[model samples]
Structures are given as C-alpha cells and as structure tokens.
Target: MKITREVVQGLYKQTGTARVDTDVAASFQVGDTIQARNINPTGHTRLPRYIRGKKGSIATDNGVFKFADSLAHGAGTQPQHLYSVRFTAQEIWGGEAPAQDSLYIDLWDDYLEPA
Candidate 1:
C-alpha cells in the first residue's frame, strides 16, 4: 500500500463513514452477552483494567475499525468490529454496588468474547 497523493486526497474527499470497511466477521452483536478478555499488554491499548474479566452485553455494533493497539505498535490495521457494551454496576463492581446503575463503554472485538 503506497501513500501517494491520490490516496491522501481520496481519503479527505470521503463523505460517508470514516470507519475502515473490512470483511472481518463480527464476533458479537447487539443483545449478545460477552465478557471482556483479561489481558495486560505491555504495549498501547484502550482496554481499561477495570473492565477486564467483567460481564456485559453488547448495546450497539459501531462497525469495523482499525485496531489502535496494533496500529500503535506498527502492526497492520487488523480491522474488526467495535461495539458499545453495557455493564451493570453490580456486574462490574460486585453485589455491594448499586443495582440501578450501569456503565457503557466502547470496546473492540479483540477485547471481548462470548460469556
């Protein structure tokens, strides 16, 4: 992939989604239950430590996008679906936490799996 003048110009000229489109299959979907993968990478990542190993449900499919963790390390885009996941306060903070509350965060597919 060359970064020629036309490539830069074409990207800036886009009118629709700025998200990268790829054929990668969605690992989860809206309403699908998932658990954040427990990981502690020594490299750049957006996955928060608090969310790791916690259970949640997919609230929205935000579509495919480049993996920032990989990008930061000079790895390929590794495009995959990103989603808005909803976690109950109880689920995340345990039974002592308020049951009426919830926390929503966007996460990439690589950070989650079926719960």
Candidate 2:
C-alpha cells in the first residue's frame, strides 16, 4: 500500500501521544562529533551492532520520530530527534578498509552523546 503523510501523521498521532524531551536536537549540528552509546544488548533495537560505541559526525537532521527503543515493546512512542551520522570506514572496520570511505547511519537522540 502507498503510504502518505497523512497516514504517517495518523500513526504517530495515535501511537506517539506521549511527550518526550525533544530539546536534545538543539545540542547537535552538522559536523558535530557524537558517540553512539554502548547500550546493553537487549530487546529490539534499531542501532546496529557494528556501530556501537563508535564516534561519528552529524551529517543531517532527520527530524523527530517515535523512539524505537520504547516503541519496539509496546511502550509508548516517545518522540525524539533523529539524525544522519557519518562514520569513517576506518572507524567501523579498520585502517585497512579505506581511508576515504565513510558510512552514514540514522540514529536517535538517546543513542548518541558528545564525543
């Protein structure tokens, strides 16, 4: 089925009625170095395994959405900021990977901290 903005908004409106601290986005900007939090491996998570504890720079703001950590298990959709973070291949793989290669990942506000 084709999804529309109204459908997305309706979903959020129904599932994300709970409010959350969204001001965290104001602390980040493009090029800001951020470290992905090494959260305990448990339950469903959107944060990739390879990117845990890795440092990256904010590439873009992907706007606020329902926090996956909470939404995965019937918890209310606590809205939070999402951003595109760029990580060097060397940081993710190793020095032998490629000096100029990088990977971008979309991450939630709770999963990142100032590096």
lDDT of all the models against the reference?
A: 0.92, 0.85
| Candidate number achieving the greatest lDDT relative to the actual structure | 1
Q: Across residues 2-99, which tens digit of lDDT does each residue of candidate 2 receive? A: 99998888886656433454554455888899999998757999998899999999999877777888888788786888889999999999889989
Model 2, which residues run further than 4 Å from truth? 1-25
Clashing pairs in 1: none
* Residue lDDT tens for model 1, 36-108: 9999999899999999999999999999988889989898888899999999999988999988999999999
- Mark the 10 consecutive residues where model 2 has the least summed lDDT: 16-25
TM-score (C-alpha, index-matched) for candidate 2: 0.76
C-alpha displacement of 7 in model 1, angstroms? Answer: 20
Candidate 1 local Cα displacement, residue 41, angstroms: 0.3
Q: What TM-score fits each model? A: 0.81, 0.76
C-alpha-based local distance difference test score of model 1 = 0.92
